[model samples]
Target chain A: MDAIDCDVHCAPDSYEALFPHLSEYWRQYITEAGIRVNGLAHAYPRGVGATAPSTYEALADRVLDRRGVRFVILNCLTGFETHRNAYFGAAVASAINDWVREEFLARDEGLRASLVVSTISPEDAVAEIERVGEDRRFVQVLLPVRSDLPWGHKNNHAVFAAARERGLQVALHAWGRAGKAPTPSGFTTTYLEDYVGNQSIAQGQVLSFVSEGVFERFPDLRVVLIECGFAWLPPLLWRFDKDWKGVWREVPWLGRRPSEYVREHFRATTAPAHLPRDPVLLDQLLEMLDGPGMLTYASDYPHEHGDGLAGLLDRLGEEQRRSVMWSTAAELYGLAGNPAASSRA
Target chain B: MSHVEVRSGGAPVTKRGVELVDCDVHAQATEPMLAQYLSAPARRLLERYGRRTPRVTEWYPRARNAGMRVDAWPGKPGHIWGSDPELMRAQLLDEFGIDYAVLEVLSGQDCYDHPDFAAEWNHAINQWQLEEWLSFDPRLRGTIAVPHEYPALAVAEIERRAGDERFVAVLLPASAAEQLGSPKYWPIYEAAAAYGRPVAFHTGGYVDHRGPGYPSYYLEYHVGNGIVMQSQLASMVAGGMFEAVPGLRVVLTECGVAWAAALQWSLDAAWELMRDDHPRLERRPSEYIREHVWFTTQPIEEPDDPKQLVWAIEQAGIGERLLFATDYPHWDFDSPKQALPRVMDASLRRAILCENALELYGLPRERAVP
Candidate 1:
């Protein structure tokens, strides 16, 4: 019954807590944006959602400990700490990773953090990944899905290259900053536009990266969608395949069908599922997605959303649940490479 | 007696040709004929007082009426359905082999020229809308447009076209004329019920139309505009439109499935709390709504999201009434061929894609596409 949460949001308190103290330049960006995050934006109230290692200990004690959760993959949300000008995004990311290392992963053997990347600039994002690239504590490089543009645009290749070079997973999460999608019906579009952050951009990003042959160029590189609802993925994949037929001849870099690229490279999670725990249905969904192999469970805990231990148990069987709980993620993050699984502490 | 999809495998899982119902297509009037329906005395008085006489040009460009073929039109697809609707039908229906699609008025919805002209415009559009459907666009069907602002005009218009039988349903914004539940608008609903016409309510921003604060691109606009349908549903229920006009079926378009369920629950909850307010209502609000309110899951995004369709059906409690739509010629057009979820049983597909809509609108099934 061991469990692992591949998709979890962790943030920090006042921007200063992560950096402790920042240079004059970074502080100016935060002040100028006039950003006011709504209450309940992240996992915790007093701290960035999971800035403290104790956050993992608490989650283990509350959810995994009882459910036998052995590890939890952490996707930090400090990317939310934004600025109007692009300069500070990288600085904030660098400082936040340092804090995540010192706090959440400092002692929690079960913790695997996805280092946050600033959308503000490509060079800064690459540098931050390089700075923390050597640590086993970080497995994926997180990017917020926020714009209307496709992710394959050559301007983004630098970021994609950095991710490939570092052997890090490119995981896309929607922070609450995506621009709107055009829909005349205007009833809060279900899939791409349904959520607060742009799910459309996330789909577009996934499509862009694959269609551009990011995966084909770097075969070992893997991509994941965290906290992305399951419903939008299938149709979008179909669309990706359908649209690429006439167009990919123009974008010659791609060696295979976009859907084929996704099947070979991509993974998605069933977090924040709209339906309450329905095991029979969830199994069918996993099968459709290519099997339980493609999915790993993450109960966005503390918030009622993750629904704590009960909801996690909803989808688990004696053995299958155990894989998502720890083993599969163990394989994905190259966790088997770590001696930590054997560590008594 | 059936094993659902397996037991009833005869239904079509996919359609050939352009088998569609552009559920919300509109047809506008040509020149003075449309204006002739409005109140001329009111027009003169308003003009005398310096109120701008509303012009048709404001909402429509003359180019829309120009007859152009669908595949032939280049650039933006906005002009695809040009002046000759018969051409649109020929291309989309007869040419592409669309079984049948419903055609509504694209414009001329507001301020009729005179009651008689309103009656005639309503009659002619319904007639033209039907003829347009019946012509080369063999796949087309009529969706009668009503003068939502004037109920008597709407009733007279519905009655006049009632004989043709091509008029599928009476088209009205759930919240048109600002006084929907009031007694003033009951006549039209009554006429629709008498004639077995269902009421189709598409989310019309007859008022405000702005996107969410950060809609930076085309994607954002698609999600932001669909919210108005909720307001339409709310006003329709709060106004007691369903109860006031029993047997008057309603279809809520553009609003996504999740909200419709919420509205159904909220309306029922309100009915319980304020039963005295609606003495005329025979049953709970949700009961009437679930019975009467059908929803079009068109421009349907999140087709892969496993529960989206199921949740919508559960919420409306109208599995038979949830119709499939592509919102063709829009940024997020869903090709029904690819959009139908794998789990959607074959019967549900046929029922949602055409049967329910056809039954509600009284569309001819034989002439749907062939």
Candidate 2:
């Protein structure tokens, strides 16, 4: 069975790579400010070999051809989501979207891209989503996990609404704004804390989405947590379901258990899999998580998380393996007519 | 100690013949009650403000009865839940057959911006707990509430209470202005270790409880408790707090347990990638966690499949480290009789419910049931 990589990261080599896509005003602004895309440098430090493919050809060579995946979704995180200035953020988001389209999606038939949006302003984010979301190749709207407020807040609901209207899923990728504290307490002193914090932050987002009734408002809206570990979900959902039972009146719109909403609406990319090394334990965890239904394959190229994927796959049944490796993501992105079937046709 | 009324008739212990230790039991204190233990200047300040300390704005509205179980409240007018020791003993200790219950008074005084005022408030809370609650019940123990933001003051508070055998742990908020593991707070850890009192990071505090600003509902805030605990655990592991104070033991109370295994795995992965960044004398993150940290199973993670919950516990490899707790008087209190999974091994169940806490708090194995 062919696999579908849900979170293959792509970025411009530098700010200069986006110059062609950017307006002259932003071009000059970026140049003058000496703005460079750090790309989770704190979390995925340079010395640890955390580089992404800067071009489609490079990505194709590195992941597509090597991994033998049927489809790969390109998530372009150019540090635009962290911009403080709304206008600058919007422009950069637009440029990154445009750059991903022309430089990656337009070049590869198998490639689909996530629409980059400015998280600083909901209106701007919605506009960006609406503008670029018309393209069938753009399967999801990409938002950074780190934000001034959670994505489920009513103020930010429009972004999700816009994506839903455009038939685009929202993908919250790990390692968002560096300015925001990784933890609720405050800034983390080391890279390890900041890195592990992605999973923690993802849990908060899941709670926010469920508690704020984001699913109730947009019943069909789906979310994918990319690079955020999936192992934490079962426990988080357990807690969520338990807490919601006591406080369901507060969020009366939630007609069902929070876990039910999550199971129906959410999918997570399996990269940097935080699974137990013991196969028996891993299998038990998978059973608890309903992993086949929730997880999709993602190489998270150039980021080394050891051989967790192999261990995870070895623990799963053939059907469950196929679901995680291909069908789940294929169904999620609505990737109809597999190339294998189409080629024969 | 002042004489307090006791109900001679109380509910029978449910877990008959089983050793039970409750790791978390809040002994609530009202403003006027805490004021009695405060210094003259602090008492005047309390009167001037009409409250013991400035209330930190709780952005999200809590559940009914201010997140307290309605039944746990004393029937008397103006009395709060867990305020009357006799009521708590009837409802929690005697009723549940809890051999030892660690008393934590979450006064929210530690969140006070004024260092001096915060210290005074925490000191008052400690005194009140000792005199009123601890002295009232032989089954009860104390957790020293300190102004954790001010380490020197926190160290002094720990030292002052170090001689008291009743105080089992030093209480710090899970959410704080800085990660509890930061070097700035190492002095507090050192003091806790020196006294052989484990540092317990309980759920609520002054710090924002969600990573992405504040949440919209109390449900979110409640769920964020686990997230905050994960972050603190990671911070402690990465900050080398265990290595800095090798004897220092940490306990995460009222935070969910199942997520710890995943967090440990993620930490181990990240440490492997960024080991060079932290060279403070070496060990895998999970090793340190397994060796040093303990988790209280209150508001325990109840997965649909009971077996799955057991698997999660086993995966965490901290079965011996699990301390059972019933967050008494809270709306979502876990009952000692029904909390642990029936599927869990008898030995592990005993370890979580009684033995682990007995060893951690250095309590006697054979305490007479009151």
Question: Best TM-score goes to which candidate?
Answer: 2
- Cα error of candidate 2 at position B232, Å: 0.4
* CA lDDT scores, all candidates in order: 0.55, 0.83
Each prediction's number of clashing residue pairs? 45, 0
lDDT of 1 by residue, B1-370 (tens): 0111221257543224222455654444454333344457543543464322254334422222221223434344333333356545544444434465665564535543555444555555565555444554545556677766778778777887777665677787633445344456678778988999777766442422222222222222223334445444444555567766767887766545544543443345335444554466667656766777787776553433556555445545677777766544333445567666667677777777777776777665443112
* Model 2 lDDT per residue over B1-370, tens place: 1223333468443222338899988888888888887789878877886543334435666776788888887987757888899899999987887788998888853475467877888888899989888899888999999988899999999999999999999998887778888898899999999999999889877656546777878788888878888888888988888998999999999999998888888888777767787887399999999999999999898888888888888888899999999999888899999999899999999899988998999987654344
A45 in model 2: Cα distance from truth in Å? 2.0
Interface RMSD of each: 10.8, 1.3
- lDDT (Cα, tens digit) per residue for candidate 1, span A205-282: 565566556776678777777665443454445445544553444457777766678766777665644332355544
DockQ of each candidate, alpha-carbon based: 0.03, 0.72
Best candidate according to DockQ: 2
Off by over 4 Å in 2: A337-345, B1-18, B50-57, B108-110, B368-370
lDDT of 2 by residue, A177-255 (tens): 7666767767888777777788888888888888888999998888999988888888998888888888889899989
Which 10-residue window of candidate 1 chain A scores lowest in summed lDDT? Answer: A183-192
